[model samples]
Every structure is written in structure tokens, then in C-alpha cells.
Target: MGALVTLELPDDSPIHDLPWIITFGPLGDDDEWEPVVCGPYERPHALALAESVVADEDLMAVVEPLLPRLSADEIRGEIAASRIAAEDDAVQTEDADIYGDYEDLLDDEPGPETVQQHAEARPAPSPEELRAGMARIADKLGNLSG
Candidate 1:
């Protein structure tokens, strides 16, 4: 199975509309390298802009506004749960008050109801959901331009 890759990056401004070539890692002698022009590349221009953004700083600031809206969906898909442990911890801390409320409720009754309800109520979405959400967000973002 192929791994999924996501890069939420800034646009290639000041260099926008410029053509580029896409290539994979080292190719064998028998295998010819595939090079596609900017318009025909499988991925969108935003991704190329993003990749170029990582390699170049001047383009980063131009796409700042688009980053936040796409970050969550991409984070969910590309970042492993283990990799985001600290962020998860921070998120838990942000919801500490709710946790405290649950603690208070549990303190009143050391029973299974609280655990069961919480487990059943809380939902962890599948990867496909994340992909769809990200695609939707990307489409919305792509639409904003003229």
C-alpha cells in the first residue's frame, strides 16, 4: 500500500504562473524519468507552490492566509497520532475544564456509566473523512483566487 502525503504550504507568489517540472526520487538506469510541465502535473498548483514555499521564503508570506484553513485537515491525515502527542496534550489541557467536570461527576459515582458514555460519544473519524474534508477545504481555497 502506498503512503499518503500531505503538505500544507504557502503559495508561490511573485513566482506564480511560472512553469515547473515534477520528478520522483532516483530512477533506475532502465527507468526513464517522468517530467511533466506545470499545467499537466497530477497534483495541483497549490501543492507545487507549497513545496516551492518550503524551499523559498519569499513565497511564504503571500499564502499565509490559506495555511490556517488547510492545516487541521492536513494535520489529521499526514501527522500520526504519536507524532502529535504534545499537541494532543495541549488540546487536552485546553479542554481541562470539561475533564474536570467529568472528574467531578466520576467522584460522585465510581461507576462504569461515565466511561461508557464518554467512549461511545467521542468519535475518531476515519482517514477517508479527513481526505474528503481536506479536499473540500482545498477546493474552497482554490476558488478564492480570480
Candidate 2:
């Protein structure tokens, strides 16, 4: 038996404003058979029509809402944005791979003195400090909720 399904869209979606269509295709592997697409009808009407069509033939039906077409400028802008993002990612990858001058390498490897200095510079917070920080965070969250 052939099955029928409708594509559900959210109530606020723009697609719900547009007309719906019913697409019928073979249930089995029938490459020679072409899909039959019918109409710009109301959602309810499309579902009814699809049900009737599916009953007769061994075909699956899908009721879908049409989407608005994108303008040429919109397409170009999207492509340009994608290209820029890709280029930026490539640049970042190349930068990460590069290890600078010998001085830069020497600076990255912290000597015993440097490591000791770093440890002294940033000591762990005291218990009182931790409690105060948590209280402050709780106050901020309470304010946001209220």
C-alpha cells in the first residue's frame, strides 16, 4: 500500500502563507516513472487531492508548501559572504601553522624562572573570595529573572 505524508510547517512560518502542492512519486524503484506534481492549492485541499491520488496508484504523496524565490542580489551576497568566511578560515589555519622567528620559539618555552614567576603572579582565590564571587553571580542571575 502507498503511503501519504504532509510536510508540517510552524504557524508563524512564511511558507504557510504561500500555496501548497502535492507531489506523487512511485513507491518502488521505478526510475523510468516521473513524479507528478500538482498544484498551488490550499493546504487542506492539497491534502485531500493527494489522498485521492495515492489511493489509485502505487505511489507515495507529499504535500509541501512553496517557498519564495531568492533575488539575484541576495544570491550574490550570500556567495560573497561564504567566500569571505572560507578565505578568513584558510588565513587563520595558515597563521596557526607558522612558528615565527627563533626568539618567538624561545619565548614560548617558559624557563623554570618564568614558570615560577607566572605561578606567583596568579595565585588561587581564597575561600572567602570564591564565596563572594558566587554570591555576586547569584545576585546577577536573580536580578535578571526578576
Per TM-score, the best of the predicted structures is 2
Clashing pairs in 2: none
Worst 10 residues of 1 by lDDT: 57-66
User: What is the C-alpha lDDT profile of model 1 across 65-131, one tens digit per residue?
Assistant: 2222234555675567656887888788878755454555444645455433334444556667766
How displaced is residue 5 in candidate 2, in Å?
A: 2.9
Candidate 1 lDDT:
0.44
Residue runs of model 2 more than 4 Å from their true location after superposition: 11-14, 73-146
Clashing residue pairs found in predicted model 1: none
Tell me the tens digit of each residue's lDDT in model 2 across 1-146. 67798866678877666678888888886544778898767787898888887787788998998643344455567789999999999889778977444565444765456333334445545657766865785577568746
